[model samples]
Target: MTETITRPLSTEEVSEATGIPAGTLRYMRHCGTGPRSYRLGRSVRYDTSDVAAWLAAQKAATARGGDAA
Candidate 1:
């Protein structure tokens, strides 16, 4: 049997994927208004699934013509 492994994304990768600046991501994280994240030792990571869900919510909000928050 074979299994697939998914790894968490780094901040830079997330920024590239979302078109959001890394600094903004850091600021959002500080303000508690960013995608869900996990901390391991001195590094921060984000699950691709969580980021996808967050993006979906943003699209839904945009379609509804309201703040994504």
Candidate 2:
């Protein structure tokens, strides 16, 4: 059996993908209002799937007349 490994994304990379600033990502993390993240050593990282899931959840919430982000 073989296993595939994926490197976690940093704040800057996630910001580039989502158009949210790095600082805002950090703030959202602090407020517990954003996508899930894990502490890798002293750096924070986000899983790509988690980011996608969070975006989908936000979109669904907005469609239901709720605020996203």
Candidate 3:
């Protein structure tokens, strides 16, 4: 089986995919509360897998009888 390559997403792409506003996404980054991101020289990129993992973690946290606050 051939391995699939996942492309990194731009901030706008990530915001579109997650239904989050671009400004909110930028604020999250500034607050360091968003999914892990990387800086490529001057461009910012988010991994789809990282976003999915963050969602799973949020679900698990909520499932543990704790409020995300």
Candidate 4:
């Protein structure tokens, strides 16, 4: 049987994918207001699924006139 492996994304990659600046992503992480992430050896890693889920949550919040930050 064959299996697929998905690796986590770096801040730069996430910035490119979401159009959010890398610095902003870092700041968000510091403020605990960004997508879920984890530390992998001294680097922060973000799971693709978590990013998608976070984006969805932000969209929902915005639609409901809640703080989307």
Provide TM-scores for the models: 0.80, 0.83, 0.76, 0.83
Cα displacement (angstroms), candidate 3, residue 12, comes to: 0.6
lDDT of 3 by residue, 29-61 (tens): 999988889997798999889989987887777
TM-score of 3: 0.76
Full-model lDDT, candidate 3: 0.87
Task: Candidate 1: list runs displaced more than 4 Å.
Answer: 1-4, 64-69
Per-prediction tally of clashes = 0, 0, 0, 0
- Give me the displacement of residue 2 in model 1, in angstroms: 9.7
- For 1-69, candidate 2 gives per-residue lDDT tens digits of 996768899989999999999999999999999999999999999999899999999987777655569
When summed lDDT is taken over every stretch of 10 residues in candidate 2, the lowest stretch is 59-68
- lDDT string, candidate 1, 1-69, tens digits: 996668999999999999999999889889988888889788999999988998898877678555567
lDDT value, residue 3 of candidate 3: 78
lDDT of each: 0.89, 0.92, 0.87, 0.95
Strongest candidate by lDDT = 4
Which scores greater on TM-score, model 1 or model 4? 4
